[model samples]
Target: MPLQPSSAGTWLRAVLLAGVVVLLVSLIVAIILGASALTGGKQESSPKMLKWKDRGTTRNLQEVILGRCYSYVTAHYPELRDKDCLKIWESLKHAFIYKNPCNITAEDYQPLMELASHPIPCNKSLFWSKTNDLVHRYTKSNHNFLTLEDTLLGYMADRISWCGDPSAPGINYESCPKRSECESNPSSVFWKKASKMFAEAACGVVQVMLNGSVETGAFRSSSIFGSIEISNLNPDKVSAVQIWLMHDIGGPQSESCSGHSIKRLKGVLEERNFKITCEENHRPVQLLQCVNNPDHADCRLCSSNVETP
Candidate 1:
């Protein structure tokens, strides 16, 4: 004997099954959505964190520039007011903002150069290659020579890296391309432009300090001094180029006044129709070294010799 089910019972069972199927589908969809949200969150958070960190550094740079400008002008250039400092900062910003960090060229900085440009006194210009620390110390201690870094703009921007992002409104401090990585990077372009201006403004006699201990010798055709500054020197304006061949206190002198490389540099200057002179261990440089290291035997000899280069 078989018993027949009631219509209501059968209808109820169908309804219950449909509801379970719908619930299962909804659960699967929710799980998928939850996973997607977590993945998207991870992907977006990294760049945001990087951007935030970089933004802070960039703001710090702005403050540093303003402070350096104020300090430099107040101490050395009293004629320039705070307003002038503001103007300089604004001009500097306009040079590289809203551009590709790696694509900025020296020409792009022309406006800033013109805005910050000031006259460098004749015969006071000092240039150097591979002698950054010594040259800066010499220039600072003896105020008679003015290196490119002595200028207002150069003083403010030295040893800092800054570049712009086309997507952002400000500097790309986090990932600015290095000078070695990109020739047209903002830092390199700036130095090139500034060096050119410095060189062009050089008049009368300009003293250049070159490293005698370097295997490349006192002059490298690739250095900023050799490639940019030397070529930019106006023969009519500059009477002579004095080369100071600096060496280590110890021996192993690779280059000197008569080294082939020195001769080549001399020939280059003479071909440019400018009077050229070379001296090994120029007196002022040796004197400064002696003052820094009084006990070294070489320093003692330097102090005893008062001969001019």
Candidate 2:
């Protein structure tokens, strides 16, 4: 077998080359298995693994917020023209970014609220319960009344859904949690904090528009208007609470100014030592509703024969 030295050297080199090929194959398999384990055998995350289930975060959030803030300062409240819209956007982002969506607290929004704070003049604050559309329409047509949406803080973030995640890009665009899913949901917490601030700043005579047509009654103690706004109103600043209990133009009136719910509201205000006034189908509000149903019975001129308490 020791015939030739050149032949023996060639055979040894062939053996070494075969061993290197085996080693390279093992390394490639190890790399692939490690990557699979890291991602749980999936190339991308499943939708079922997303944090929220209701709706995804709003698209173009930054642009929309900045636009609204600038518009509000320039067109609506020019007095706030000095405010830094960019800083406000930053504060809002800081409140929920890279955090648990369900764990965001009202305190997280404190900076944003403070940054957007402004005075609500006397006799202009308008609160509403179960009368969102009518109240907003009324406020829009009659500039004297200002709802939460009319304010700088609410204006910027109104009708938008947003939440943060512990993942890359920070915000979870797949979905956002509902208030029922978690009490500290970012949107709910923000609105609660903003509503509280709005209520506290209300001065002079405040107005509240309630839907009397609802079978559940016009006022609920659990509502933001009931739980937050009415409770936080300053007795020293606000002289009275004027409640306009409105009913649908063509719908039945389930709760009047003298209904049990109205009486309950009256009792609450009295207990808090704030003067109260109640009017059913407030003429101005009813008139606005009439615009759409001009041919309906309730839209007639005689509909102004409203009940009062």
Candidate 3:
């Protein structure tokens, strides 16, 4: 079957065209399969990667930090106007990023602490335990005292939660470990470190507002105030530790100036060679609490209690 040269050439061209079509089809199939695999992986991993243990890592963490930093330097703390917010954020990031949520230590936040530190004026420090709301209210109204939360180091992250992961995205947006779950969690570590610094810097006469209504008494050996702040206080700089035992207006007073806990606190201070003073229902703070409960007996003026004929 000898064929013409032109016919043989046409037959060869048909075979080449068929081979090209097969190669193109195989390439398209491979691309589709690869894309599908990537998408499926992302779908399978989304929840686990983002899951949290309690309230997840705070959303918009970077934005919130930057905003707070700028606001602090520009408004709340004009003295810190020269601070680099970006650098502060970077310091915070490096401390916890790619680290296990349960393993972050107080030392990890040292860089951030240094970046945000400022001198707390003497005699203006106000420490509190179990009286968060009232203590803050007293500070706002008095303007003569400042709590740790009022300072630059605490102001930037107060009332917010945040944590990191050892994986990609770095931060877990689902939840962070509770303080009880991980004592060394990022938030807990930060406050412990911050509280220590605040206590150490306090000088002259300092105030501590404690809740007298706490059943366990006003002072606890485990509290930040008792544990971190108390140990860090310098007797040479501090003339006295003024303790204000405040109870809710018209509320049951479970503890007092002479309660077992108060005596223990006194012992600690005396052992440390620092003068201590205790005042139950400190007048100034009591007056502030009475603003909303003017009718309460505790809020009534002593003169109004005079016996009638």
Please list the Cα RMSD from the true structure of every candidate, rounded to 1 decimal place: 7.7, 3.9, 5.5
Instruction: Give the local distance difference test score of model 3.
Output: 0.86
Q: What's each prediction's TM-score?
A: 0.78, 0.86, 0.86
lDDT of 2 by residue, 253-300 (tens): 898888998899989999998988888888989889989999998777
**Predicted structure with the largest lDDT when compared to the true one:** 2
User: What lDDT tens digits, residue by residue, belong to model 3 across residues 1-309?
Assistant: 898999999999999999999999999999888887988835344434535458977788888899999998998778889999999989988998877888998889988998889988999999999999999988878878999998877888889888888877888887788887878888889999999999999999999999999888899999999999999998999998888888888788898788899989999999998888888888888888888898988888612111111
Candidate 2: residue 11 Cα off by (Å): 14
Query: In lDDT terms, how accurate is model 1?
Result: 0.79
> Which should have the higher TM-score, number 1 or number 3?
3
Give the backbone clash total of model 1.
0
Clashing pairs in 3: 52-175, 56-174, 56-175
Name the runs in model 3 displaced over 4 angstroms.
1-47, 50-52, 302-309
Find the 10 residues in a row with the least total lDDT in model 1. Answer: 46-55
Clashing pairs in 2: none
